[model samples]
Target: MLQILNEEGEVVNEKAMPDLSDDELKELMRRMVYTRIWDQRALSLNRQGRLGFYAPVAGQEASMLASEFAMEDEDWLLPSYRDIPQLVFHGLPLTKAFLYSRGHFMGGQIPEGVNALMPQIIIAAQCTQCAGIALGLKKRGKKNVAFTYFGDGATSQGDFYEGLNFAGAYQAPAVFISQNNRFAISVPVEKQTASKTLAQKSVAAGIRGIQVDGMDPLAVYAATKEARENAVNGEGPTLIETLTYRYGPHTTAGDDPTRYRTEELDNEWEKKDPLIRFRKFLENKGLWSKEEEEKTVEQAKDDIKAALKEADNTPKQKVTDLIKIMSETLPYNLQEQLEEYTEKESK
Candidate 1:
C-alpha cells in the first residue's frame, strides 16, 4: 500500500510526500478538523432526533477530505451517501446537507456552479453516472474530470463493473475512489470478496489502479492528485482503494458494529487515527499548534450551529410542493393528489 506518513506520524516515504506549501497543508488539516467536528455534531443531532439518517464519519476523514482536497472546483463530484463532507467542501451549502439528511426535497437541488450531484443513496449507482459525466466533459472539450467515491462493498454490485467498463472503453476522464473501510455494514472484507486487493479489480477494466493507506492524508492526497492529472490528460480513469476504518457504527439507524468488530481490531486501527497523526506531523513542522486547533474546533462548532439553525428555519415541505417540482405540468393522477393535499393543508 502507498503510504507517506506512518502510524506514528513520521514520514516513512519521503519521496512520495506531496509537494504542498505549508499554508496548503494547514488548510487541509483545518478542513479535516472541521469535517470531523461536523461528523460528531451530526451524529449527536441524529441521537437527539434533530437529524435523520446519519452515517458517522469519524475515522474516514483522510479518505474523504484529502481526496477532495486534490480536486478542482470545476470537476464533477459524484459522491455516495457517506460522502457529505466532500459535497459541503465542494460548495454545497451545509444547510442543504442537513436538509438532505432530514429528507427535504429542496436538498436535492444543486445550486448553480456547484458541479456535484446529491449523495447517491443507491449503492454503486453513482459509478455509472460518473462515467457518463466524464464522457460528457470529454466530448465538450472540457479540461475537468469526474470524480466519484464508493465503498468496497459497492465493488460487488453490477453497476460498478458496468461503469468502469464503459468509462474505460470511452477513455473517459474520471477517477473512482473506493474507501475500503473493511466492512459493508456488518460483512467483513474477507467475506465481501476473495480478491487479494480491491485495486486490482480495475485491471479487468483496463485502467490504472493503486492502493493507498487511507489513514495517511498525505498519501491519499497524492494518489488522488495523480489520478486527477491522468484523467485530465486523457489517460482514462483510475481505481484507488483506500485502506481505512470507520470507528463508529455504519449509521445512526441502529447498526451494532461490536457484533462484528473486536476490541483488538478497533484498538489497532485507533492507533492510526488520521487526525492524531496528521496533527503530530504538522506540529513537528512548526505549522500547527494546540491553540490553532482549539480555535478551529470552536469555529467549526459555531458554523455547524448556524447551519443547523438555517436548516431548522427552512419551510417544512408539503406534499403539494413535491408534486409541483416533480413536473411543470403534472400528470392527471399527481394533479388530483396535489389538489387534495393542497386543499387539506389549507384546512
Candidate 2:
C-alpha cells in the first residue's frame, strides 16, 4: 500500500517517501537506464549468436536496483540466473557479467569484498543455500544478513518452503525476495498456485510477509530496507513479493512469449515501464532532463559495447582447464575416461 509515485509519475505521497538526495535519485535513474541498455544488448548478442543465452530484465529494473541499494556491503546475495541487474547494481563489473553470459569459468569467481554467490541455474536451489548462509552467519555471530532472490514459480518448489521454515525456526537473518513476474516461463501464476497472493504463502512459515509495487523504486527500496533491518536485529526472516513483470521473453533462445501473450498486454506494460516512470518522477522534481537522460543512455551503450568487445577478446576457455579444476583426486573410472579423451584430442 506504500506508494511514492503514481502511475503517471506524479509524487502522490512524498511525506511517506525516503528523503533521497538529488544525486542519489539521479544515480538510481542512471542505473535503471543502464540495466535496460545492458539487457537489450545482451539479448541482441544472443540473437546474433555471440552469447549463449540471456534473461532480459526489461521491466523489473526498479525492483532489482532498489533492493540491491537497500543492502549493506557485507550482506550476502543469493541470486538466480535472471538477477543480473541485481548483481550489476551491487557494483559487479559489466565485463564480468559479459564473461558470465559467454560461459567463462572465471565469471563464476566472486569478486573480492562482494558477498555474492554465482547465479544458480537450477530453479529455486538458491533458497536453501541462502538459508544455510544465514544460519552460518548467525552461528558465527556475524551481523550480516542474506538476501535471496527467486521467482514466483519457485514458491511451489519444496526447497522454498523448507528454506523459509528453517530460517524462521532458527531465527536466521535472511530476507526472501520473490520477483513475482506473474509467470514462470510459460506457466501463469494462476496455474502455479491458488494462493490469492504469493506473500500469503509466507504466513505458515512464521515470517513477516509484505507485497510492494515493484515498478516503483522507492517502494522496493523501502520494503527491503525494513526487512533488512529486521533481519540484522534478529527478528528472523521476511518474505517480500515484488509485483513486477518481464517485458520480453523469459530468456533468449527460449520459448516465445508472443504465442502466450498478446501485443496489447505488452504495450500496456510498456506504458508502465519502470525506467520511464522513474525518469518522469525525477523530471518532476527538477532533477532530471532530456539532455541528461540522453547522455546516460549513450554512456551505458558505450559501456555495453566495450564489455561485449572485452568478452569477445578474452582467450577461449581450454577444455583441459575444466578437467584440471575438477576434483583434486578423480575417481579411477573418471580418470581413465579423462585420460582417453585427452589422448584423442592430442591426435
Candidate 3:
C-alpha cells in the first residue's frame, strides 16, 4: 500500500511525501478539521429533523479532501452522494449543499462556471458521467481532467467497468477515486468483491491503478496529484483505491452500523483517524496549535449555521416549479401539469 504517514502521523516514507509548503500543509489540516465539524453538525441537524437525507462523512476526510485538494478549479468533478465536501470545495455553495439535503430542486442545478454535477445518489452513475465529460474535454483540446469518486460497492456494478473501459479505450483524461470505506451500507467490502485490492481491478480496463493508505492525507494527495498529471498528459485514466473506514453509520437514514460492524473493528480504525494523524504531523512542524483548531471549529460551526439558515429561508419548491425547470418551453403535457399544479397550489 502507498503510505507516507503511519498511524501516529510520523513520516514513514520521506521520499513519497508531496512537496507541500508549510502553509499548504496547514491548510490541508484545517480543511479536514472543518469537514469533521461539519459532519458532526450535519448529523445532529439530521437527528433534529432540520435536514433530510444525510450521509455521514467522518473518517474518510483524508481520502476525499486530499484528492480534491490536488485538483484544479478547471477540472470537472463528478461526486457520489457522500461527496458533498468535494462539491463545496470545487465551487458549489454550502447553502446549496444544505438545500440539496433538504431535497430542493435548485440544489440539482449547478451554478454557471462550476464544473461539477449534483451529488449522484445512484450507484456508480458518476463514473460513467465522468468518463463522458473527460472524453469531451479531450475532444475540445482542454487540458482539464474529469475526476470522480465512488465507493467500493460501486466497483461491483457494471457501470463501473463500463466507465473505466470507455475511458481506457478513448484515453480520456479521467481520474477515478474509490473511497473504499470498508462497507457499502451494511454490506462489507469483502462481500462486494474478491479482488485483492480494488485498484488492481483497473488492469482489466487497460489503465494504471494504485492502492493508497486512505487515512494518510499526504499519501492520498501525492497519489491524486500524480494521477491528475498523468491524465492531463494523455496517459489515459487511473483508478485509485483509498483504503479507509467510515466511523459513523453509512448515513442518517435509519442505518445502525453496530448491527454489521463490531466495536473492536471501530476502535482499531479510530487509532488511525485522519484528523488526529494529520494534526500531529502539522504540530510537529509547528504549523498547527489548539488555538488554530479551536478557531477553525468555531468558523465551521458559524458557516454551517449560516448555510442552514439560507436553506431554511429559500422558498419551498412547488410541483409547478419543478415542471417549469425541466425545459425552456414546457411540452404540452408538462405545461398542462404545471398549470394544474399552479392552480391547485393557489387554493
Candidate 4:
C-alpha cells in the first residue's frame, strides 16, 4: 500500500507528488467542498421526500475527486450509483444529477459531450462494459481509455474477474477502481471476500495493481495519473484499491447501518476525515484558509439552491412518453402495454 499523506495533516513523501499546480490544488479543494455540500443537500432532499434513491458520498470526496481529477476530459468514465460527484466533475451537470436522484428518465440518459455511461445500478456490471469499451478504443487506435468504479463487494462478483481477464488477455486500455469503503451495503468487507487486498486481484489477470490511501487525495491522484499513463501507453489495465469509508447509510432507502456497524467504527474513520486533512495541507501551503473555505461553502450553497430550483422547474416525465422511448419503434407488446396504461391513466 502507498500512503503519501498521513492522517494528521502531514505529507509523508513530498518527492512523490503528482503534477498538480497550486491553482489546480485550490480547484480540487473547491470541488471537494462543493461536492460535500451537494451530498448533504441530496441527503436532505431524500429525507424530505423530494428526491428518489441516493447514495451519499459525503466522506469519500478525496477518494472520488482525486482519482477523477486525474483523468482528462476525453477519457472514459463508467461510474456506479455513488459516483455521481465524479461524473459531474467529468461533465455531468449538477441539475442532471439532481434529476437522477429524482428518478427522472432524462437524468439517466447520457447527455451530449459527456463520455460516461449512466451510473451502473447492478453492482459490478460496469466492469465488463469497461473492458468492452476499452477494447473498442484500443482497436480504433484511440489514445483515450476507459475506467470504472465499483466497491469492495463488487470484487466478489463474476463480472469483476471476467472483465479483468478479458482486458488482460488482450491488454486492453482499461482501469478498474475499487472504492473499498469497508462495506458493501450491510455486508462488511471481511465477510465479502478472502483476498487480503483487493488490488492484488489484478495480479491474477497479469495487470498492474496498486493500493493508495484513499483518504489522501494526492496519493489517489498520483496513482490514477500513473495508471492512466501506463494504460494509454499500451501497458494495459491497472486496478486501484482506494481505502476509504462512507459516513452515512449506503443508500437513502432507510438501511440503518447501526445494525451491522458500530458507532465507534464511524467515529474512528471520522478522525481521518479527507476534507480536514486536505484543508490542512493546503493551508500550510498558503493555498487555503478557513475564511476561503467559508466563502466557497456560501457559493456552493447558492449554486445548489439554484440547481434545486432548476430541477424543480424541469417537467415530470409521463408514463406514455416513458414507454414510447423504450424503443425507436415500440414492439407490439410494448405498444399494447403503453396504450393500455395510457388509457387507464386517462380515466
* TM-score of each predicted structure versus truth: 0.99, 0.95, 0.99, 0.97
Candidate 1 regions exceeding 4 Å error are none
- Predicted structure 4: clash tally: 0
Q: What is the lDDT of residue 135 in candidate 4?
A: 98
The residue-level lDDT of candidate 2 at 248 comes to 88
The model with the greater lDDT, 2 or 3, is: 3
lDDT of each: 0.95, 0.86, 0.94, 0.92
Model 3 scores a C-alpha lDDT of: 0.94
| Candidate 2 vs. true structure, TM-score | 0.95
lDDT of 4 by residue, 51-80 (tens): 899998988999999999988888999999
Give the clashing pairs for model 1: none
Candidate 3 residues lying further than 4 Å off, grouped into runs, are: none
* RMSD (CA, Å), each prediction: 0.7, 1.6, 0.8, 1.2
Candidate 1: tens digits of C-alpha lDDT, residues 1-347: 99999988899999998989999999999999998999889988998999999888899999999999999999999999899999999999999999999999988898999999999989999999999999999999999999999999999999999999999999999999999999978899889899999999999999999999999999999999999999999999999999999999998889999999999999999999999999999999999999999999999999999999999999999988899999888999999998899999999
* Model 2 ranges with Cα > 4 A deviation: 345-347
Off by over 4 Å in 4: 344-347
